[model samples]
Target: MTKLLQWLLGVSLLGAVWALVAFDLLELSLPRTYREVAWPIPLYLLVSFGCYSLATVGYRVATFNDCNEAASELHEQIKEAKEDLRKKGLKM
Candidate 1:
């Protein structure tokens, strides 16, 4: 159920973004008679949807538990091993 809700949320957010982009395009291309009463709706929606999309990206990034720190630590260990090997004239 949680996964389903998450999927729905993502889909709805993307749909909102698509709607805003479509609205903005139509607003630019269509005649004055075909335009909406409020010109800001698309811009507002676009910004809001953009924020949500960014938030989703942020969430994913946070969940990933990045390995850069671990990699750097391992690299430091390797560097120390190389230094020790050079000091001892040992092949490693």
Candidate 2:
């Protein structure tokens, strides 16, 4: 499946399970400690994911490469365009 749908399904499944346990929807009689722990787990997960995403973006940007040849070629194209424009009686 597409990545968006996959992420949505996974998140929804986790939320359903967390709700079922934290709210004791089935009256399973889980211990107080268990419910207390489950309540904050989603928050912990969200914070950790945020940290991970930040690190990943930082790493990728730090390692990104420069394209000097492409830069020179773009400069040449701009010069050629300017020359053509000048020949066509365009002033700047």
TM-score for each candidate, following the candidate numbering: 0.31, 0.65
RMSD of each: 10.9, 4.8
Residues 1-92 of candidate 2: C-alpha lDDT, one tens digit per residue: 99999999999999999998899899999999889999999999999999999999999999998999999999999999999999999999
Which stretches in model 1 have alpha-carbon errors above 4 Å?
1-38, 68-80, 87-92
- lDDT winner among the candidates? 2
Could you tell me the TM-score of candidate 2?
0.65
What's the lDDT for all of these models?
Answer: 0.76, 0.96
State candidate 1's TM-score: 0.31
Q: Which stretch of 10 consecutive residues in model 2 shows the poorest summed lDDT? A: 32-41
